[model samples]
Target: MSSLNTNTNIKSEIDIRKKANYKTEGSDNIRTKKQKKYVLIDGHVYDFLKRSFDIIFAIMFLMIASPVMLVVAFLIKLEDGGPIVHARICIGKNNREYKMYKFRSMIPNADQMFQLFTPEQMERYKVGAKFDDDPRLTRVGKFIRRISIDELPQLFSVVRNDMSVIGPRPVIEREAAAYGENRNKLLSVKPGITGWWQVNGRSDCAYLSDEAKNLQLYYVDHRSMGLDIKILLKTFKVVFYGKGAR
Candidate 1:
């Protein structure tokens, strides 16, 4: 009996040693992987700089556009009796939800009408599919959207840190859900009021069919302060000329 007890003790000690060795090796491997995981551009310093730029741009844009914003609000209400701006839930960085504001381009209660007309609406919306002569649009809304002024309200969102002036456009939660692996890259930056897709021509571009990959990959590989400025200038030209519009 004593011999058997000794044998059991030896086996238990061996098992404990094996487990300890495994844990040590496993922990070391985990540490090594963590060390190798981060890319240089995505390091802590780059993140801090990126955030600083976003904040600075947000503040200045809000200040500069304040007067224009008030004028837009007044015109919207003057043309028709409805809310000056529209707000909807938009997905942000990290799959977070925030209310996004835009100039109201559709009639009141259009949200309710959306379900009934979705299939029919697809035929109407072309070049990213829009009803060129949508009955729901008010006179002021038409003018506002033509010049892309309808998007000006989102400067407030940029200031609020709910959005960026230049990132990929925010997808709705439903859109985000369909993203799958794309969401990982898409949600890395805050959604922008204007983006690669916007400047490339929202009106001329295909929907998720053709343009999504161009915008998505461009955003992932080539995002920079200079790129954002370039896109803004391009947007100005597009809006001014009324080229490729809905």
Candidate 2:
């Protein structure tokens, strides 16, 4: 009888221990969920402010840049009698695809011209989806891209809520694939016109490279109003100096 009692006590003790561990694990999971919820709530205010600023800034800048945009449009049309705006499908927040607009900075049907690239040019294009001296650029294309005037039309995208003023620059589908498992994280926030990557080194840091990936991920993880302001200031400097404009 005593042995049976002892066995019963051991069984009870084991049952108690199992319950304790289960409770601990359950509580841990609840805590993790709560923490994630808190982060989302905390970022809500920041997102609101950022969106407000994007609209105001884009609208104001668009008004100021209207004359320049008209001149660019005229020049592009006169140069080749082709479309003045280039619309590209880029991956945006939450893996949503959107059309991103830029002033036409390349000849008409430039995408079809890729097959004509020389081996060296093709290799360089594979590195960053850009050419150091692309033959596809029109005379005016070269000038506008050099000064980043080509990017002005993206203000319309910002106003449309398709992009942010300071975030990772939107990537084409092929470029987005390079993010691999981290693609969701990269697309967790809206892509930007000028970003940490733009101000850091632009084309010098190849989009396919690990350095570029880390820099872009760093921005996504650490973005805030202060960081946005710093990026904006640096962007002006970069534009004026034409740093890494290739």
Candidate 3:
């Protein structure tokens, strides 16, 4: 948070410098050079709508998928003989840590063997990245993950007010910590099970990078009810088409 404040101040300084430079050039440049403040234009109405949508949509899905979730839960136990659901902490709004739930998709000891993989593999696993041929995934896990049937359990989290239906994907706290200066803005909103990254091009958390600050910044700066609906509509396409699978 301290770093974010410092970075914000630095940007403010840079904007001031750019305005001064524009003055020496021409009057036409002045209008274009005005500093854009980060203000969420929609305010309380947007927040209310975002929450209402999360709750209404989550409840609706849970009702429709109750049978499928039950079947998937049973299949998980029969496949690997472990807990049917998996839960772990992810950084959310204001970078607060909260437990997120998903149907168990890997071996019970999946975390124990994670260190054996190279740096390339570490990101994917930590950020809930599951490969199509990932051996750690049980047979049932593959099917659920492919259709994102595995993520249905998170409706409970949305019900509990710990997550959003649309926003940036939740990341591990360490992953947030690794962001250094950019973490605060990213953490300002609740993490979602699906968001622009998934809809735009990303599939998993293991691929996070510090240089993605622009994308992260865009999310906070431009998030709106209309944009949220657009993202949600796009997410449906990703889920049905298995957009991120490899």
Q: Could you give me the TM-score of model 3 versus the true structure?
A: 0.76
Error of 3 at 22 (Å): 33
TM-score between candidate 1 and the true structure: 0.74
lDDT per residue, candidate 1, 76-152, as tens digits? Answer: 88887899889999889888889998889888876666554556665654224565666677888888888887887
Q: Rank the candidates by TM-score, best first.
A: 2, 3, 1
TM-score of every candidate relative to the true structure: 0.74, 0.83, 0.76
Please list all clashing residue pairs in model 3, or write none if there are none. 94-187, 123-206, 124-206
lDDT of each: 0.76, 0.92, 0.78
How much is the lDDT of residue 86 in candidate 3?
Answer: 91
Put the candidates in lDDT order, highest first.
Answer: 2, 3, 1
Model 2 residue runs over 4 Å out of place are 1-41
Error of 2 at 38 (Å): 6.9
Model 1: ten consecutive residues of lowest lDDT: 122-131
For model 2, residues 95-167, the per-residue Cα lDDT tens digits are 9999999999898899899877889899878878565579999999999998999999999999999999999
lDDT of 2 at 116: 72
Clashing pairs in model 1, backbone N/Cα/C closer than 3 A: 125-129, 125-130, 126-129, 126-130
Best by lDDT: 2
